[model samples]
Target: MSATSVPRARRRSAAPPSVDGWELFAPGIRGEGTAARRAWRSRYVRQSAILDAAAAAIAGFAGYYLWFVVFAAYGPRPPLWAVLVFPVVWVPVMLVARAYEERFLWIGVEEYRRVLNAAVLVLALVATVSWGLRLDVARGLVVVTLPLATLLTVSGRLAHRHWLRRARQRGEHLQTTILVGSRETVAALDEQLQRTPEQGYKVIGCCLPSRERSTGADAFNGLPVLGGVTDVVDVVHRFEVDTVAVLPGPEIHGSVLRRLGWQLEDTDAELLLAPAVTDVVGPRVHIRPVAGLPLLHMERPELTGVRRWTKELVDRSAAAMGLLLLSPVLLAIAVAVCLDSRGPVFFRQERVGRCGETFTMLKFRSMVQGAPKLVEDLTRADEGNGVLFKMRHDPRVTRVGRTLRRYSLDELPQLINVLRGDMSLVGPRPPLAKEVEKYGLDMHRRFLVKPGLTGLWQVSGRSDLSWDDSVRIDVRYVENWSLTFDVMILWKTVGAVLRGSGAY
Candidate 1:
């Protein structure tokens, strides 16, 4: 305080940051670490249970099937030499096929493929060893067991998958999910959560960005947006938030968000970026690291190689099978149609199929004889994606037509279109010529593959989907075409048809 002496400038200490009660912010009313531990425990417990059941099933089947093959081949254990085949050859084949892998145990199509691979590989090894050793392996036994066991194993796995799916529906085992985003983002996330309940993302709360006015204490969609960007680390530690979905927005600065992500490194929490890129799939997004920046690159649709072969095969096989199987049904429908409507059994409409090609797509006449003339009058009443004309209860529909349209039975005649190679078992649903005319350049890619009898649009809420949603699904399909994907979509189509969802 001496005037002559320079007053020592008082060095100010930084104020200590305020902290919320850890218990209040804990995830699911449990302490943060405890909640995480519980979640981890639950996951392993469920997995172990599944693994135990799978192991038992595989072991039992493998043992019995081996016995049957051995007995039938060499008649009640011919020699130690013959018996040696089971362990050396068969077991290795099973392992190579990944029959014991958890991924294929209850998986669809992959399970079937694994079973086939296991059987074929085992049999091949058996043959090779038999030939090399000059041992007569009974051809009859191999022939009978190969296809039969493969079918049985696949069937068994399918049955188990059904039970597992049902158990999940009943909420036997579910994973907890903590969403961190705005109300709209959380709500959108919740919608996806509803659809895939089996994935078991139990939304604990949507952690909101902090408020400037007061301490962060708020809820979005009944789930707490417990804290904001600044307090995220604390929120994670406090809430035991397992999955932190950083929903992209303006309020959270990119650099600050990056720092928060870095802080998450030490925690057990998984950080997920919920990019606003809706409907686009993983195969499309390529991440390019430019200096320190992560650039997201979307590749244009490429249809080539095995995809072309698979598409060709699927189109041929499915179309042929559909035509043959539906022939009788088509005949019956034809008779009914002729009787009820006094019009041609088949309605041929000039629809735009793959690559701007004009195809007379076949359909069971769902409208009156002169229905095309009525388009002008119905134009104003269009309920379709603006470009397409549709009515939930079109007045032009015949009595038989109404029934056909209800279950998408009218579209059944597209099997003929399929057989003609103008359609596929799975592709974008063909657009009408008028609809195609209105399409932007992006929409044109949908025509790259043969149009389908049933497609993403059909199974994914159909008429209920917005134009953008429909377009996106179509585009996604074009960009990510695969035989396995096509089969899955076709399988879902059966359920969708049975439910009559979104079909008018």
Candidate 2:
């Protein structure tokens, strides 16, 4: 049945009750819709305040004891009032820094960044006051307390986030969302929200433009098509939506958006507009108001300069230290590989690196000596996403090889590559020469940075990712490379390796 042929009554029934009736009869429904979200937000904020206060208190007391009691001879004793008042001051400082804002809570790196910024501000204020007043402030106490507080606060937030994620996974705490856009844009936004359920967006339905609405189709991408764009306010009231996400498109322009915002003013649902740009977030994009209009200003990615040099220095230093510290484990893996297989303990394969340069990537030999030769015979059994060859249980894997691969012990030799500048501590996965040969134009963007010992690809399902997904992640990492991002991936890599999923 075509959309035009659909009965008028059926279309009206598909939409919510008339706006006037819903408003007059269901005034209390608005409060019920937002109660859960408001409650969750309040609870989270309260918990965060408690955690921050406790962290500050612990650091303050511990620092005072260590400085005045243990190292009493080295510095003048500070007054006990300073220690007692630290938590009182710290929580307000965090509030001033916007650390506990609802927007920053439970998601994104911004929360952690705000916490760190607040800690720094507190330390600076303390140091300046002490110096200006000529007070006998113990340098040791100042040094230890601020850092300890920051660490404790961040740790607490991380644990809280983990708990929240578990809750979201169980469908306990989630924003009831209604997506408004063209079907294509709605589906895309829905897919992303579905992909990261921990972000806490639970899309209940979508509102499409009248022209975009299908005739007989009542659902799209498994979500019901609630109504047309004009029906958004009624749909929100009827469904008790906590969030209404509008995707940018021709049908929903400035005037239409303004009207929608005005209509939602009396309701509890928050409005969110998703710009067309994708995979570009954080500091790269900023909103600049010019000529009374807010315009998005995107800065070019910084692929080089002081930050890049700093990253290189940190990578080399970390790689050198890691190689030194893990020498025993490396030795053990080497011995095991040698005893279990006739091949050399190390496997060196030519891999494409930064700027399409070639390097010999090293790994503990986890396959038979003649495994490369067997590729043709086993092509039919390839389990990879086409670009790479992967087999969960290959015949070529030695007894010890399976264990090494499972735990990613075989990749330990890549530390030498990192130290040698052939790779980074975290970067795009190094592509094999054959894999690079099959690359399209955009895929070459992966070579913009050095390959990694472990990267977004490594931690994000590794071999289980489709070829397109692998490429997309690599390019995203290249375009948004940051020291913090590298650290995040490295941290997640530890957990991924322990879980041992998708690491054949």
Best by lDDT: 2
**Per-residue lDDT of 111-224 in model 2, one digit per residue for the tens?**
999999998899889889988998877778888888999999999999999999999898667777889999889977876786678888877778888887757566666667
TM-score of model 2 relative to the true fold? 0.88
TM-scores of the candidates in the order shown:
0.68, 0.88
Q: In terms of TM-score, which candidate is strongest?
A: 2
Candidate 2: where are CA atoms >4 Å away?
Answer: 1-32, 74-82, 120-140
Whole-model lDDT values for every prediction:
0.67, 0.84
The TM-score of predicted model 1 comes to 0.68
